[model samples]
Target: MGQFIISVGREYGSGGHYIASILAERFNVPMYDRNMLDQLAERNGIDAENLYKHEEMKRQGLHRTVRGHSSSVQDSIAQLQFNFIREKAESGESFVVVGRCAENVLRDNPALISIFVRGEEDAKVERISRLYKLNRIEAKAKMFRHDKKRKAYHNYYSKMKWGDSRGYDFCVNSSLMGVEATAEALYSMLSTYLKSKEQ
Candidate 1:
């Protein structure tokens, strides 16, 4: 087949980023995550660390825009990132992009394969707790906060709902079989998909 992109959208603490990384390794392609912001920052002379810290923050007193109008700094940065993602797609590179509304940004491309990952609430909380050294209650709270921000950010930037199964070509629950197994299953499915495309 030709160049294709794996665009993954996921809920907080779902191991979606880890899954995306595995798929990228299996496919021997680059994986784009929040690090895209660093590159964008460098290119545009922005502060990378500050951008990372505030990338998903919502600004008060600002309304969403259409017709190329951006009323907030976050919106401007998002537009720049979207343009960067489109450029990467146009460059004929096969890669996996995690979040940043990549599913919608590359929606029109035939090479796009969008995936959404979610997990059971308990699983998410546990994962977050272990990863960040927080207690279960704190982890649950953090997860909710992150998910809320993600939902808002994605909803504001894309036409589709974040983590909505209807918006993705494949939606998987990482909790059902754990993260590694989930990644393996997805990789197998993608392998079959690639073969079908070749035929």
Candidate 2:
């Protein structure tokens, strides 16, 4: 299998995580998602759960931006996490990294292939409601709120605008293609892409 670095940026309920899992299985590469937080916390002496909580708090405007925070704890995690992601690439390992601004972290690496996954609002809300057992209204709110948080996080952390199709090598709309189809398409495309690069 070709060694390729794939980073996926996605909106909530877009099946981004599922797509990444499929890719990792197909590529036989390590895939990282929330586990990156576990690694960051373990390495830096922070509680693992708090990493997610802190991010949520910041997203809700309960805390200032990482750079503006008085103690800058958020900033520290960002740096450590960025380093963690980079180190994985530096390890000469093929990987599918999802979220956490991984696209920005590895943007300069020639091996990097960034993908963005998006879906229609109704489709996303439907999936969120079904999977999470939330009511229609609750699911809608949760869905939109998540998008807002993601945009805030990406805008603050990366050069590319969150969910901008132009920034990624591939953009998939699961609303049209479905999760499995999107994953299959990505695998086929990435295989061809890696092969072309080797020629």
Clash number for each model? 0, 0
Candidate 1 weakest lDDT stretch, 10 residues: 53-62
lDDT (C-alpha, whole model) for all candidates = 0.89, 0.84
Global Cα lDDT for candidate 2: 0.84
lDDT of 1: 0.89
Q: Considering every candidate listed, which one attains the maximal TM-score? A: 1
Off by over 4 Å in 2: 56-70
> What is model 2's C-alpha RMSD?
2.7
